[model samples]
Target: MEKRQLTYKDAGVDIEAGETLVERIKPFAKRTFDSNVLAGIGGFGAGYLMPKGYREPVLVSGTDGVGTKLKVAQMANVHDTVGIDLVAMCVNDILTVGAKPLFFLDYFATGKLSVDVAADVVKGIAKGCEIAGCALIGGETAEMPDFYPEGEYDLAGFVVGVVEREDYVTGESISPGDVVLGLASSGIHSNGYSLVRKLFFEVLGLKVDDYVEELHSKVYEALLEPTRIYVKSVLKLLEEVPVKGMAHITGGGIPGNLVRVLPEGVDAVIEKGSWPFLPIFKFIQEKGNVPEEEMFKTFNMGIGYVVIVSPQHADRARQLLSEMGEKVFRIGEIVEGRGRVVLK
Candidate 1:
């Protein structure tokens, strides 16, 4: 009888592959570094120096994962964009409170580590941080044998931001007559993918590469459009406009998310048709035969983010956002009522 020696790689984990991925992604992460990033990738823990300015600085933090959207990316063999969706999901949430994103971190886990795919994903993450004006400080990559199937991985992100204590937009200031502005979404920005997949694949029998005239792109292209990052634009608008409240529309769509920001005495009255519904949404609604209310609840529809300001500041806010290259719409207004959202 003889015994055979086994190594980590034999167990489906490649230590060398992990190290190689670290090397490949270093340059990508470094590109997002700012002076405040005390230490970046390859460290046991990343370090960041808080910018010195606010009298009472408040640290805001958010964490999120790119829910089943990763499946779409994997099916399409598109690894890069979902990383942006991961960062956008977290950063946008913290931005709702007027926090300026300071840094980001990510978690990637899979059965077998493919250095090339992982690198592409990290590259996209760095790109997201650059767009967000934040440093990609550090992250973790785990190769768990048999945990995830081959060629499949999951992503999660964490972001830290800072805002002055008095400057935090708590939605408490959202009152009657405040205008609700809708910021155009970049088509199916990271939500409702479960239904999307069903409609396009199982029901419609569409392939990832199948092109549809209505969407003007392949199925995956429309479904995997990276979630829009509103940090820079919203942060800039906050400086010039008194944004009473802000909501990063995610899983629950506009009504579910926007209602969270309404004060006890006000309701958000969203006027339908005020904003252009992107073709993807229209296609999903018509193809899925999803009811109007269900569409608003499950998907962002068109608005990725919502900002509330006094009527006096609405026009100015819209102009500034538009000048910043955003498709801004005066979609609704706040009214006196119990805290809720009403679509008209």
Candidate 2:
């Protein structure tokens, strides 16, 4: 009797399929390129040149996964938007450090390879990279036949960026009188979804197809909207404002995220009433009865990014952000205290 031959294809993983997907994605990937992108898809390593004329450029890299949002994607059978969520997670963190995103990489794992499914995911990543002014440099697609259920997959992103040492933005320069400028968020942005899932699905008996105004879509569409990418518009305002520190309101919401940058003697004192809360947040508030404090610390509440700048420059900073097509609010102030964030 002849024995069966062993092959990667026999294990339900297909290199040929991956190659075909890469070929298909190349055109879409190229749209994100700048002159610095030295190579495209199908390379052992993706390359980008150091932007010319940086006095002392420091490379920044951040790796992140879209926590639990993947569950929403899997449940809804929507794979595209989660790829954007992957990129947003990394790029948003890099933006907090004043870095210009250069390139991004993704890691996708599934029990079985589906070209159509993965292609939808990559399309989202390419679009996200384009928005962040970054290239889709490289990524890993793993097919672990027995590791996950056939219909389930996971996605994560790694992003690299560059910022000059002298031009870096951090909390060292943040002072007591600096104003806290809040940039409004679109829904929850990517955190607290596990709780949301419990609320909408398990507890309330809501189906993915159920329509809710708070979600602004059939439950699935509402959940699948990509996390907003804020790098480009805010980077443009760097010229006119004296930014001392910045924070991306993510998993820990305002208090948790903002305090990451507070100096030893300065704290972020936020007043909740300065800006109008989006109805979605209010819906969650009423439906969940999530206390104001729990809501602020657990979710973005409304603000996606918090900017610290001088007291006198507050108006100009707020004005410049507003001029750039952003909703701005003087949400709080810096106070002389321990390095912590306080919400009023």
Candidate 3:
């Protein structure tokens, strides 16, 4: 047998394809640039100038991935919206600290580079930046040979924002008698898909296109709903109201994430039955036989973002948020106790 010469392409990595994908994505990324963005794609690094108005500004940065939800996207052949989830998972965390998103970057890695799929995902990233009022300054796309399964890729996002030094919403100010106002979620926002996939694929053997009456949609659509972005509504609330603390409900649910924003001697008590029912949760619970506590621990349930304000401002805060088109719920209150969360 004659030996064949090996090349990078033969090894399944195509530098030209990666370059071509970059060319295809430039215009999409350019659409998200703001005046603060000082450079374009293909640069060794991105450049962003601080916005001029703040007398004292603090930089806030966050990074997050889409988790196993990427598998659901692959199964549905829906690459676009997971990018939105990628951006949401990070920017929403920065929002908890009262920062305004200034720019975003992404990491995209795959076994093989599919221009169409990568472009679709970038489009969603650009759209999310627009929704968040940030610029998609840059990103990296890696085509690793035989690393990820065919037709599979992973996405992560990084967001940078700025908050006035005095305006940072550290939970230090949270005290007893503060009210917790929860903002409704869009549906299963970017957490707990390991169990979701087990229920849908392993246990129930449900297909991506399978429809359930509770969700009134295909399994993939319901599960892959983009994570909600609370930037606009939250920024508006901070402008007009005083927020003692805030939390972005993610992997650990209300009890988990909310506790991060409580004072040492205070606790949050979430009142059950205070908000509208989210049907997808009921479906997941019944289908997986998942306990209520585990479900709350793993998922966001109906509430995605929580704001703790003094009791005097609770109603006004809710009214202001509602006026801005947020589905507001008086979910709980802070009380004197060790820093913790209790649901009753």
Candidate 4:
């Protein structure tokens, strides 16, 4: 008897499927390319020319994953928006330091590669880069048999940005009497989904498609809302206003993230109710019986980004951001205290 021949696909790796995905994603990557992109997708390494016009350019980079939120997208069979979340999480962090995002890359890993799913995910990533005014130069897609569960994938994103060394906003300039302005979030921007999942699924026995009157949308729709990329508006604001400090509110919500940008001898005193609480937060609080403090610490609440400016420039900054289509709010003010965030 002759032994049967086996191939890579038989062992759960599909080289052809991976190749097809690359072909499908090339167009999506192309639309995001700018003059500075020396090399893009399908290369051994991507190359981006350093931007001109800065006397002293500083490179800023950040990396982050979608966390357990990917589980929700997988459960709903929705694979697109999480890619945006992936880009937003990384780029937004670096943006806090007044960096202008230059280029982005992604890492996608799964047990088996689904060409269609991977294409959709890449399309969303390209869309995010377009929104952020960055180039999606390259990415890695790994298919590991028995590593990830069937039909599930994980996403990680990396972003590189540049800022003039003299213009870097390190939060050291934050001082008493500076006004705190918040840029409203587009509903649950890619954090705290572990608790969100428990309260909606295990506790309430809700399905992804189920709709509650309070939320006014399906569970997956609200949970999968892609994170807002503030790169454009904030970058524009930086040109016309003197922004003393900035914070991208993520995992630690207001208290955890806001305090990072507070200099010693001053505290960020956030005025509660200064901004409207989105209904999803209200639903989570009411349904899960979660404490107010826990809710603020775990999720973004309503504000996604915080900008600190002097009182003289506060009104002008708010006007500029609002005109740029962001829901802006004067959420708090810097006061004399130790480096901390106090919620009133």
Candidate 5:
């Protein structure tokens, strides 16, 4: 017989590496497990049990990727926090509809798998799921050599949640003089990094490893800080009050996102200087001379989210959200218009 050799590595996928990673992450993933979880790591399908007595229970699902912000994570070699960003991006959208996130799954793809790095990513995901009261049921790890260059990978997440049909929130009741309440973001919540990378690395010659003016960590760390999942606090308030509308400020920032839930002929007028924006935004604007209009269109700037509510409910909403440690503000009011968001 002719000499023949067979190798798993030769086919460009690392089975052993994937196995080691699953082993490393198994313990951490189990930390977020609850009674409903039906499968462990490496399973083909994740399983969960829906709770009983949720009248007219509706399933709310959302999936999102980290966008080009992954470039900053790869540049900083910081894999841990981006995993939280991945989960938050998906889960937060579910919350906008007054849903409770029940379970989550992730997909990580890379050129060559590193057990330590992949575990770091999973640890953050587990931490997020824990905080959000959701089970980390299962995930996928793909190692492809040709598709992605070495040391580069992408992350995506899917979240499923439940909401009673009677309690679901939409801006159907939003009317003129309804208050626009702003919630401060921890930092940039995993959006608009395409221009950020260009401004810092390409235009200004700043390295991701270098510390900028006010930020204590590398530029990438400040930018790559994980997405904040607001499911817990917001869901708590939903149980007590009707949240007329909510906006998740992501790629299109305030103008595009806040207008998403506005009823026709209702407008949101936001005060430009109501909440303080983080220093990073100023740094990029000064360095790159990016226009104010483009910045608002592209980045979240200062506010991560805004809740549209009746003026009567604004004070109570702020009080409840403030009790949860969020800096809430009365940034604007609704007015008569045709699906418009005005920054005053």
Candidate 6:
């Protein structure tokens, strides 16, 4: 008997497959490139020229993952849109500070690399970058045997954006009378999926394709609706109006995320019925018997982003956002109190 030596391929790391993936994704990534992207894909590090227009440029950066929503994508055999969720999670966070996203990178890891599935995911990421108007400069794809089960992969996204120091929306200007406006979410927008899965799988035992009259679609479609990217509308608003503060609703929900930008001695009071509640949320609450408070603190509950503006600008802001095709809601207002979020 002879012992054979092992190569990296024998250990399940396919350098060739990664190289092929890089080739497949180049055109897609190139579509998202602007003049500032200094280099193309497959580089050791991405290069970007500092945008020339800002008088006092401040680089803003954020990183995030799709959370367990990736599991929903895996179960449904839907690999494309979670990449959008990945980009939305990070870019939306940077948008909170009024930054315009400049470039994006991603990390993909799996036990086995399926070229088709990986390509589909990266195409979605590139599409997301196009929608957000950012360049996809570089990414990492790792095939680690035993690290992830076959047909399963995890994704993470990183984004760098820039804003002038004078234009950063820090919420410091959020005064007692500032109005809180809510932007309707596209379905759940990628949070609270642990509970969502528990309700749909454990309690209700619903399959991805199972139809519910309430959702008016398959169970997985509603659950996997890609996270909404508010960058365009928010960026436009920042240019015309002085947004006192902005909050991108994510894992912690409206109250959880909104409080981060509130000034001391001020609280936000959200009206319960100010916005049209999406049916999926009602279905979840009724089926799971989830508490009302938990619902506000856990899910976007239809509101994906919030804008704080002075009373004079609230109506105009709502109008501008609506004209931009957003579903806007005048949901709340700031009040004098210890920094807190109040859902009335």
* lDDT (Cα, tens digit) per residue for candidate 4, span 204-270: 9999999888888999999999999999999999999999999999999999999988888999999
For 85-191, candidate 2 gives per-residue lDDT tens digits of: 88888998998878999999888899988888888999999999988889997888888889998788888899999998877887798987889999988767789
What value of lDDT does candidate 6 attain over all alpha carbons?
0.92
Count of steric clashes across candidates, in order = 0, 0, 0, 0, 0, 0
After TM-score superposition, the amount by which residue 102's alpha carbon in candidate 5 deviates from its true location, in angstroms, is 0.6
Candidate number with greatest lDDT: 4
* Candidate 5 per-residue lDDT over residues 1-344, each given as its tens digit: 99779787988888989988888888888888888888867777878888787979999999998888888877788878888888888888888888899898999999988888888889989988887888888899999888998888888999999999988888888999899988888888888887888878888888888887666677877888777778788887776666899988999999999989999998889998988888878777777898998889988888887787787888889888888888887899999999899987
Candidate 6 global TM-score: 0.98
All models: lDDT?
A: 0.92, 0.86, 0.92, 0.94, 0.85, 0.92
Worst 10 residues of 3 by lDDT: 34-43
Instruction: Estimate the TM-score of every prediction.
Output: 0.99, 0.96, 0.97, 0.99, 0.97, 0.98
Write down the RMSD of candidate 5 (Cα, Å): 1.3
lDDT of 3 by residue, 1-344 (tens): 99999999999998988898889999989989988889968888999999999999999999999999999999999988998998899999999999999999999999998999999999999989888889999999989988998999989899999999999989998888889999999999999999999999999999999998889998988998999998998999999999999999999999999988887999899997899759999989998999999999999989999999999999989998998888999998889999999999
Tell me how candidate 2 scores on lDDT. Answer: 0.86
| Model 2 / residue 309 / CA error / Å | 0.5
Error in Å for residue 149 of model 5: 0.5
**What global local distance difference test value does model 1 have?**
0.92
Give the clashing residue pairs of candidate 1, or none: none
In model 4, the runs with Cα more than 4 Å from the true position are: none
The total of clashing pairs for model 6 equals: 0
What C-alpha root-mean-square deviation, in Å, does candidate 1 show against the real structure?
0.8
Better of 3 and 5 by TM-score: 3
Q: How would you encode candidate 6's per-residue C-alpha lDDT over 180-269 as one tens digit per residue?
A: 999999989888999999999999988988999888999988998998899899888887888999999988888899999998989999
Q: What is the lDDT for 267 in model 2?
A: 79
